[model samples]
Target: MQIRLLDLLSRIKRLQEEREILRRNQALELLKTLKKEYEELVEERKKVSQVFTKSRFFKAVELQDLIRLRDSLLEWEKIAEKKLKDGYEELAKIEEELLERHKERRLFERLKEKEMWKQSEEELKRLYRELDELALLIQGQENKR
Candidate 1:
């Protein structure tokens, strides 16, 4: 029964480690996606700026169109910036959660170790008592002889 319990505890520890790894991988993927989006936004803003500048050489109607495009790009840039900020906030929360999980798993592992040590100590004591009894029986036989 003790061996079975110990095996169960070992399995639980392994599962916890696997879960932590999965969560870490997901967080990394999210961060990568956010970074890619942020980079794209930056590129789009640069293109808009170039177009706005080149509008100076265009006719009145084309210049007006370019101005509208520039305004729209500015609004999109603001939205993208907010999304990026939110992504960072989510990443921070995930990191904190991972840290807490690690601590909890460590606590459980320590408990399991302590239990194993206690069981071993008890087994050693039992063996010593058996040996002492056998020694007494041998001494009694010798005295009788």
Candidate 2:
């Protein structure tokens, strides 16, 4: 039973590591996509600025609308960046928890193994003592004969 527990613990640890690695890979992919988005937003801001200088088509009403739209997009991008950072922190917390669980499982397995060994040893000793007593009784009966 102790050995079985050790095997179960090992399997759980392996699964934890696999989950962590997959999460890290997902984060990397998101980072790449974000980088591309950041570049595109910079280009878009430049284009909007050029509209004010290069064209009379954007007057009071149009200018306000353009500015509002740009601001909203910028806010969305900031939120996305924040989420990316928070995702890393959450993953780190999960890793720490897994480490603690692994440690606990190892300690439990060691204690169980020690208990099993002691029980087997005590049983063997008791059997040996019984055999010795029987041998002594037989020898005494033969001497009387």
Candidate 3:
């Protein structure tokens, strides 16, 4: 029963760790994508602004479009930053718990191994004693013969 419980808990911890890892990877990947998109938007906006500056005339419509794009991208980046921060914190917590669970599981496994060794030793001793008795009985019968 104890071993079963330990095994179950170990499996649970491993699963929890796997889930956290996946979440962290996904969060990081999203952040990377957002960064790439933001960079592309900035480059596109810079090119347009430069073109307008050289012409010495601001096209109000184009300027407004650029502003909207920048605003939306910034908003997305803000949200993604928050999500990444939260995910990192959660992953840290899960990792800490995983470390503790691993220690506990290792201790239990060691104790279980020691107990099994003791039982085997006792069984071997019993077998030896039985063999000794059988040998004595055979000797007696041969002497009578």
Question: How do the predictions measure up, each by TM-score?
Answer: 0.80, 0.57, 0.55
Which clashing pairs does model 3 show?
A: none
Off by over 4 Å in 3: 1-56, 124-145
Q: Residue 142 deviation, candidate 2, in Å?
A: 2.8
Q: TM-score ranking from best to worst?
A: 1, 2, 3
| Candidate that would win on lDDT | 1
Model 1, span 1-145: residue lDDT tens: 6656755765676677677678768877876887787778778878978886765578888878867887887787787778778777776876777676667667666767888889899999999999999999999999999
lDDT of 3 by residue, 1-145 (tens): 6546655665666666666667657666766776666567566656755665777655799768866876676676567666656666766775676577566666666666676677789999999999999999999999999
lDDT of each residue in 1-145, candidate 2, tens digit only? 6656666775676676667667667766776777677667767867877776788776788889888978876877687677667766766776676576657656666766776788789989999999999899999999999
Error of 3 at 64 (Å): 2.0
On TM-score, the leading prediction is 1
Error of 3 at 87 (Å): 2.0
TM-score of 3: 0.55
| Number of clashing pairs per prediction, in order | 0, 0, 0
